[model samples]
Target: MFRRLRSPGTARALTWAAALVLIAGIVAFVTVRLGQEDKGPANVGSVPTGFASEDFDPNATITEPKESDVPQAARVAAGEFVLAAVGRENLPKAWKLADPGLKRDCACTYKEWLTGNIPVQYFPTKGLRGASFSVDEVTPGHVVLQVLLTPAASSSLKPTAFYIGLKQRGKDAPWLVDYWAPVDVIAVPASPQG
Candidate 1:
């Protein structure tokens, strides 16, 4: 085989073959990389399709329930959970408020949460000044609310909306946050002046 390759024609052919293989490998690698880039991060999880819309009627009028009708504990839990989750300084507190399913679905460890390596791509917590929530639904064991987070006036971040879900193990048990996801901005209309 060495003697055959030593021939001028055979040597040239081998060099061309090797060059073609390298070129093909490079092309394949670039194609794969570009494909992956287009698709964004592989392990970063997103809220499931139709998950936000389940039982959420955009057309229905949203009224802030009276104080007596509101589940105060659940509302408070949801508020605290949002506040904790948004502020990196309070991640541990947020982690404690999260349900097991949320931790699993978020695919983030306590360390990751601490390091802000969470997969919530659209979490609009920067410069958050206040959060107000309206009860969407409340059952004995579960509560859902639409939380509107307002950023500081000096901040460039716009007010953002999130749907938060909380659940209680028992009547006396503290509410735990099971779901936290950004509401689809498209579904919400802009102010009349805007």
Candidate 2:
């Protein structure tokens, strides 16, 4: 015996219900398989392993030799980086001075950087006269400088301040600029003793 639904509405409702059940069943099956995969033997003992031994001292410290030229070199690199970054014509030099972290942060290709499509903000260089920087912090491998850019005498633009971070690969390696940001954008960290 064959019987057709008296109401078209009932048939449409049943169709909708069947589709939902099929989707739910598929979802449940995928979820269960994923769960099993997570707990499978292949995943056993997958915890991260450390190279240090149990007897290794966590407080061990190694001192790096201090280089007399590091401060001067870092300062020179930072200044050059700032100048290069601001000048549209010096984008290639800026790209060379920038470290991997800076490049990654920029999220753009060298070609785009050359076209002045960089992440850094640019000021009117014609209106700016010069930049002066003071070393805020300096380590064996890293240096942070506070830069104050001076505006031209007739220019309406005010002076601007920025923070620049530079790093060196080794004692003899050239310093590279890794970070740059406006002074106001960076938040000061609270004192650990507080």
Candidate 3:
């Protein structure tokens, strides 16, 4: 804001106006310095936490921690922060749960190697499907997730299951899906056919 200097009160009116302008400028500067908070995309449930909110208070007592925050953290850990950031076909929420090596190996913007090796059709084009996981018996660093389908694609809408391999990274990494194979798909030959 620009204000014209009022030289030594030739007009008392002009003197008062200049003082008012100066006071207004100071108020404006402080407001600007405080800055505006970022209002992010509309979330269906509620706004997420740990995005560095300015309203956050370091010292605070909770009568009780909100129950909803638990699912919010899991969603961040499993999907949003990790999975939504990678893979070509599906929105890769994979990163949040992915191991560091796989994260690096998958390539930042591409997954050529993975796409080639992965059995894409395990994920059917139609009907309802869900995923679940179980620990591997022999392999310590591996997990097996079973993907179940309902309303079978070929026939009536009964449920079927597909088992897939998920690698456990480090001691703390969430399971990263590495191998996906449909129940009926033929096994890959160990040796090349002549």
Estimate the TM-score of every prediction: 0.56, 0.56, 0.33
Candidate number with the higher TM-score (2 or 3): 2
lDDT of 1 by residue, 1-194 (tens): 88886999998998999999999999999997897687554322332233464565555554433435557788788777766775444778988888887889878778887765553323445466887876666556777777888877885567778888888878788889888777764322221122
| 26-52 per-residue lDDT for model 2 (tens digits) | 999999788868755322223212223
List the RMSD of every prediction in angstroms.
Answer: 13.6, 15.1, 21.2
Pairs clashing in candidate 2?
Answer: none
In candidate 1, position 179 carries an lDDT of 87
Q: Give residue 54's lDDT in candidate 3 (0 to 100).
A: 57
Query: What is candidate 3's lDDT per residue for 150-185, written digit by digit as tens?
Result: 533563324555554445556665555554445565
Error of 1 at 72 (Å): 1.7
lDDT of each prediction vs. the true structure?
Answer: 0.68, 0.69, 0.40
Measured with C-alpha atoms, the lDDT of residue 128 in candidate 3 is: 32
Sequence-dependent TM-score of model 3: 0.33
Q: Residue 107 CA error for candidate 2 (Å)?
A: 1.7
Task: Report the CA-based lDDT of candidate 1 relative to the real structure.
Answer: 0.68
In model 1, which residue pairs have backbone atoms overlapping below 3 Å? none
**Residue-pair clashes per candidate, as listed?**
0, 0, 9
The model with the greater TM-score, 1 or 3, is 1
Q: If both were scored by lDDT, which would come out higher, candidate 1 or candidate 3?
A: 1
